[model samples]
Structures are given as structure tokens and as C-alpha cells.
Target: MSHSSTIARRTTPGRLRHCRTRSERGAATAEYAVTIVAACGLGGILVTLLKSDVMLNALKHLINYALKLAGVEGLEL
Candidate 1:
């Protein structure tokens, strides 16, 4: 009901709003951590697959074909 009380109420809400905006930075950090873990998991799976003999043979054939097209003799992989 008083002038100072009214001013305090107005300023209190602004302070709370400012505090809310800072929390988004913490949320972004958490999201980045989760994303990195997921990406690492995906990369691990891909590396495992690529290291398999079948995937390596497939890639080797692809490279040999490309080299043949470029007039180089096919490579022994």
C-alpha cells in the first residue's frame, strides 16, 4: 500500500526474471554433456563396424574401383 512497498514489489519480480534467464546457461551445459555422450556412443559403434573384415573389404573394393577409374592398377587390400 505504501510507495516504497510498491516499488519493492515491482523490483522483486524483475530480479526473479533475471534469475530465470541465468538458469538457461546451466541447461545448455547439461544438454551439451548429453549430446557428447550420445555422439561418443554412436562413434564407437561406427568404429567397431568399420573395423570388421566385411566393412574393410567393402571399402577396399570401393577404393580399388576408384583407382582403376583413375587409370591406376587396382590395389591389393
Candidate 2:
């Protein structure tokens, strides 16, 4: 019984080593990381596009306010 237990322990380490040496484990992690990065990049692009219109409108308002403070009237261009 003791001999069988020792053999089992030795075989377990060998199996673990073999699994770690396989390429599939690292490949899967690499693929997942690439996919996450691509998704984040795409999301950032979309958010920027969506925010730009709002930002432009706000800037226009601020410029108009500054012009009013400077005593500039409309249609003076």
C-alpha cells in the first residue's frame, strides 16, 4: 500500500509537468489577453466619438459666453 502511494505521488508530479509543458495553456491565455485588449481599444474609440459632439457644443457655449463678456455683439463678423 505504501509503495503504491509513493508511485501515485511520483506520477502526479510527472503529469503536472507534462501539462505545464503543453503549448495550449499559454496559447489560450495569450489569445484571451489579445481579445481583451482589442475590445478595450474598440470601446475607447466609440466613447471618444460619442463624447466629441457633446464637447463641441459645450465649447461653443463657452466661447459665446466669453464673447458676450467682452461686449461683442452678434453679426459683427
Candidate 3:
């Protein structure tokens, strides 16, 4: 057979479909890995921010306001 015929046989419609499916088998795994990494990064950032004095103070102030609204006073969270 000629070289061109050999190449043509490898790229027929059925062969193309099988090749495409095999190549894409890891796509979902790659997507899940990326999502997990992104979630971890976001969690780290949130932990850092929540541990900061500003966020802590804001949270305390909100708690104090809520307590005052509930008829409790002079309590510091």
C-alpha cells in the first residue's frame, strides 16, 4: 500500500471517533483537579481574612448589635 493510503486508513470516520474518545478520557479528571485547587486557595484566603483583627472586630460589633436588639446590654463578644 502507498503511504497516502496508510495515512488515510488511520483517519477514517470510525477510527477518528475512537481516537477522539481516548484523547478526552482525562478531561473530567483535569477539570476536577483544577476545581479542588481553586477551592483550597479560596479557603486559605478566607481563613486568613477571618483571622484578621478587622474581620474579628466587625463580627464582634455585629454580635453586640444583635444582643442589644434582643434586650441584652454591656456584653462584649
Candidate 4:
């Protein structure tokens, strides 16, 4: 075939695919970082909520209910 067609066949599609893959790979790193940050923020909020007196009481009640269902004595907490 022609010289230009030979060059296009060898280089163009491969280079385009490589460039797109590199850009998408960089975006994946940013996506992971944002996901980790959001997860950490959510975990912090959950920890704070669970430590509150209302949530503590609710958890204690739930535990006591489970114990009662299992025919065991409930905890005093």
C-alpha cells in the first residue's frame, strides 16, 4: 500500500487508544480519592451519632431485645 496508509494503519489507532486509556486511568485515581474521602466523612458522622446518648440507649434496647428473644438475661447497660 501507500506510505501514508501504512503509517496510519500502524500508528493512529494505537496512539489514540493509548492516550484515551492514560487519561481515563488518571481519572480513576481521582475517583478513588473522592470515594475514600466520602467514606471517611460518613464513618466519622456515624461514629459521632452512635456515641450519642439516644443512640446508645437504642442500641442497648436492641441488644436486650435480642437477648430476650434468645431466652437469655438482658444486660443492665
lDDT of each: 0.87, 0.80, 0.92, 0.85
Each prediction's TM-score versus the true structure: 0.67, 0.41, 0.67, 0.69
- TM-score between candidate 4 and the true structure: 0.69
Displacement of residue 22 (Cα, Å) in model 3 is 0.3
Top TM-score model: 4
Least accurate 10 contiguous residues by lDDT in model 1: 14-23
lDDT of each residue in 13-61, candidate 4, tens digit only: 6676666554476797799999999999999999999999999999998
Q: What lDDT score is found at residue 57 in candidate 1?
A: 94
Query: How many clashes (backbone N, Cα, C below 3 Å) per candidate?
Result: 0, 0, 0, 0
> Which regions of candidate 4 deviate over 4 angstroms?
1-22
Best lDDT goes to which candidate? Answer: 3
Off by over 4 Å in 1: 1-19, 22-25
* Model 3 regions more than 4 Å off: 1-20
Lowest summed-lDDT stretch of 10 residues in model 3?
15-24
TM-score of 1: 0.67
